[model samples]
Target chain A: MKRLVILAVLIVFCSSMAYGDAYRVSMRWSAKPGYLRLVLESGEEIIKTARVYHSYSLVKVEFQSEFSFDYENTPDAVDISHKGSSLFININGLKDVKVFRLADPSRLVIDAEIEKTANAKTVPEEPVKPYGLSDVVMVIDPGHGGYSMGLVGSDYKEKDIVLSIARSLRYTAGQAGAKVFLTRSTDKYVSIDERINSTYKKKPDVFISLHMSSSPDFVVYYAKMDTSIRSKDRYMLKYSQLGHLGDSVKLSRVMAEVLREKFKRKVRIISMPLPLLSSIGSAAITIELPDGKYFDYNASNRYALVNTILKGIGKYER
Target chain B: MKDNRYLTALISILFILVLAGGYIYLIRMHPPEIAMENKTEPSSQPVTKPGSEEHISIKLFFPEGHKLVMEEREIPRVFSQKKILREVIREFLKGPAGTGPFIMPEGVILLSVYIGSDGVAYIDLSEDLRRNFHGDAIDEYLLLKGIYESTISNIKINDVKILIDDKEVDTIGGHFYANRPLKQLVTQEIKFD
Candidate 1:
């Protein structure tokens, strides 16, 4: 009886060990206010590789292990195919994808922001008011604060420099008849999520992020639109969902011109991959000034810098 | 008999105290366990034994005065693409023999490299690369351009996706879009778009 019991226990243990790590992948999605959320629930952890084809506006995610798709349907992806051990999910009109994997429950969450044709930008041939910024709702975000000491010069930190500049700009821009909001007015640590959420919530018309860098030249960065159409597909260009890209580019150009006039040197305007600017859904740009050692921002100099930015924004408005 | 009972009670008290101490040491107040992230960090020595491995010549591009200067180097021949990439990246980080001021900061190591079936390579570098950025656009642009050019010249990969400390960051180079698939060839200076 003892031998029979021992053999039975050994057989059960071996079978359980053999089937330990096999799991099927179940996928489902739901609609949110501005974007859709895709949920991939699995018993096993996910190891994925994504390739973004900008011209096609499609993102393909490949999985390592061979798992059967237990769900029936999805909106963005159709005809889910398995090539050997790989499962590919092709998401169309994908603006950006933020993925999160939760522990305890063992599930993967994906937020997929889709590009819509309704978000196309219309830049007017001329400004509306041509005077003070009475109709502008602007948000000024200082780059770093608290312990994030951005760039260290001989005696000053980049955080302090940008904050002082931002504070001065707030005072000057507010005096010039613009309703301005600061993401951080003091020395505090703020996360990226908070910054994005605040900017998105406020629905500002123009957003300017200020910073100081060790770069020798003055630079302005605008948001890059991830979606693009094939060069031959001219008809598809109109339907492209380029939100805020046009206005951001125009604003960057305006700022570049203003800074060039003030500093009397070349100011570079480049498109960058800044999540803060991309998701703001408005005309957003980041202005990088030279290090503190080169450019001193005393009371008079601070006012001058603030006046320069205001001049740029005024140009952009009109 | 009384003495024997007292002795037994004292022994029980000591045993309970020992149990409490063990619990505190094992579970209550233990130090964090530090695990080695990458086991394949190249030592100063060659990957293989000196005379055992085959050698192949590769051209490495280093940032020299705003342009990438190609320097020929010989590396041990490895069977897999991942291994070969690791060797190449290690060599690139070591800088040129003449050492005319390499663009990258020191202590930057390649933690991991993963290449998917679609020929996209995910290269995870150490945190030093991200934290040591001094906000110089020229150095930033040249560093990435040189690394990408060197990798492409030796390998047949489609694109390279860079990750610092196993996480995707917004941008390392302030000018270019770091989040995008790095396929743009830098033939001329980075022009404003």
Candidate 2:
């Protein structure tokens, strides 16, 4: 009888704890007169007809609506307040939330504890100067798009993998306060000439080309010859790193080091003659992520690689 | 008493098997084995056989119908006359014939060369060589480095210096710092678009 009673109490406690877990809320506000749009992660739509206000040097809108509760929280659920453009929110028991504002298709982001629910009253003030490293623009080039399949891995395509990683780097770098540009957002063929020309036009502080490796049939055969023999495919593909922009060895070295550290992968900085590297006076580094038969495209590995790149960009931020 | 002994013997066998399995598992999981398998391979092939066919003389050949006349000059041997540098250069230019699609560049015209006693070979280029070559700064640097380093390495020259019309230039086209001569290492191949 005593054990049965204790078991019932334990089950009730576990159920309540699970019910109290927080959930994400996102909303998009668009097509307003002055205010364009507001999007949240929760997928909730909040349309406001309030007048725009400028306080603390930020643009904000005020609206009166009943806040819908999506997740359970403690009695002192942290209240997020926004008066102008700036937003202020505190997690109940968490710190170090990453925030970002993407500009191309403007979106404000806030990552916090999801369980807490509170009404925000004041948006924080935008900083007088941007709070990131200034005068640094990173041009991320995802190698091989469209017709170019660029190193096919068993689990994923190299082009797709590189683009995803590049996009993540761009986001993290932007958060770190660096202007970032992608050579091509979608799958499209960018010629060697165009790739170099694009860098010249952007005049980016640094140019990073992301790529992956493929196991050629020769490599598979060679492996049979000596299981210990390293694949020559890596060396054969390394010829692609050569660019025709005027020589900037220092830039190449720095970029190589940063990429190697971030990806925790083996990289060869080939000093080869190519038109793209020659024409672009900017420091350019080509990053080749491990591909087919080399590395698995798992989420944890991807996260670690992305985080390493973010850390590398952070070093150059200031 | 017989049942007790049988049970004890069975237990002893099971204990030994478990101990052996754990030992093998620990050995497999050791960190050194992981690193030994994951080491990166060396980038460039190591140079061997100083004067072997592996170190072939690269010649620059003109198109079949082109009207550029050639004059034969005595081959200079910085170290020994037996290893003729001029004969190698002349043979390289006259041997291969192809324009695009992986052949050497047309504008890479080698003029006069001065071999130093210190195994440093100084090759002079025509004034039209720089104008004829079309590539970005890094590409040009790499191309020039490749041409110079490959020639020097095959010829057993230690260092290479580039000069245009017998005058020292800061850079080939104001891109690479060619003010000082470069030492020969691995020759980087240029991929032309």
Candidate 3:
């Protein structure tokens, strides 16, 4: 019986020797403006090198040194597991994942761009946003009018196409519970000054301008400072869009994502000094649709376009 | 005695060759001053014109289909950078003599050109410059690009800050940001063989 006990103790010692004491790592999480940040930290060893592999919803990190981490505080939308020598982080819903290493103390940072709607879904009955339609106001501008005939397409003029889209956005957005206004609802020339006046008076939460162009399928733009202005006028002009630049950038991202999905095309966002948008004191973006003559302007396409804009606004609000 | 004579002949021949080589090298390096003074090439599309100490080359750009085509011209060196700038604008305002639309509107006039100590050229234009403007984004971009490209083509000037009727407006048109100078535009495109 003594020999039997000795043999069991020897087996236990051999197994413990085979697997060295595991490194204790800590995992932390926080929600940023547009993404959820996950941080894994190891104090004793610097993670000098790591292989990161990500697909649709999973981010896997294989470390040079195997470590065990407590995933107690993992968000409802995410699952964390450690197996073998790899750490697997499963993000529930997202547009993208970025994994990078930070030093000073060893750490791996994971940023998952979660869809706003998906975020709300994860938290049941917890109202995450005060962004109902009635709380949010929007202004839509249709480029050109009457004497100023926008570029002509196969069956429609640019002015005509923009007016139709602007009108559709107003109705669709209104039905969605947002107070929406249009710079010009009819086929009339609304001067840039007039549009600026409309934005100034409306003081909306978001302002969207619609147009069409060739070559590029679709483009979204927010305000960029025009460094050309000088003196007292410079102060006023610079400040006009300064306060809303961040809002515009965030809004543009949501808009671009939704528009990209709807059109199944690359949606580019740029920051340029657009006189019309720059001079207006509002969070604004201009979306230029495809102006190709062969492009279809059917009713279903229009419906999708309107829904796309509304979806973008809804996501941004959330 | 024969060896001495052979050495002298070889030395004389070597000296003459060295003199001839130096003469040819100098002739290539410095053309006759008269010829250098007289040499001037009319700038055309895609061709850059070079100038000497006595003159400055004006490189102008004009809108074609989508992009601006560059044209270089030479003018006698002036006393002030502002004067040289005016000449450049004047050449641009004259329009492309060949074909296509004028990059600048017909009635638009340059009210003044002011060069700041920091090397930014503040170009003031008449209200007609803004009032007479009509086109889309491409037209607006090309118009500003031409003016900015031509002004910076001259040396000593760094950037271009555009003004309307002596005051800074948001932009010439509602498309691009104007109140700032076109400092970011390329001054030269160095092509290698």
Candidate closest to the true structure, highest TM-score: 1
Candidate 3 TM-score on chain B? 0.64
lDDT of 2 by residue, B1-81 (tens): 999999999999999999999999887885442332233122222233346633432323222221222222223332322
lDDT of 3 by residue, B27-110 (tens): 888654324223312232122335466666677888786568887677676645567678888888888768776746588888
How do the residues A95-148 of candidate 3 rate in per-residue lDDT, one tens digit apiece? 588878888777878888864422322221322233356658999988765445
Best by lDDT: 3
lDDT of 1 at A165: 70
How would the docking of model 2 be graded? incorrect
What DockQ does model 1 achieve?
0.12
lDDT of 1 at B63: 81
DockQ of 2: 0.04
lDDT (C-alpha) at residue A7 in model 3: 100
Lowest lDDT 10-residue stretch of candidate 1 chain A: A117-126
lDDT of 2 by residue, A1-318 (tens): 999999999999998665433222334332221112234432112222223343211233333332332323312223245433333332222212434454433334433322111111111222222434455787888766544445543344555566656665666566557788988655545666567667777877667766663321110000001112246632322222333233345544454566666555555545443334434445565555665466755445565566555454445443
Candidate 3 clashes between residue pairs 3 or more apart in a chain or in different chains: A133-A177, A227-B180, A228-B179, A228-B180, A229-B179, B160-B181
Clashing residue pairs, backbone N/CA/C < 3 A, model 1: A127-A318
- Candidate 1: residue B1 Cα off by (Å): 64
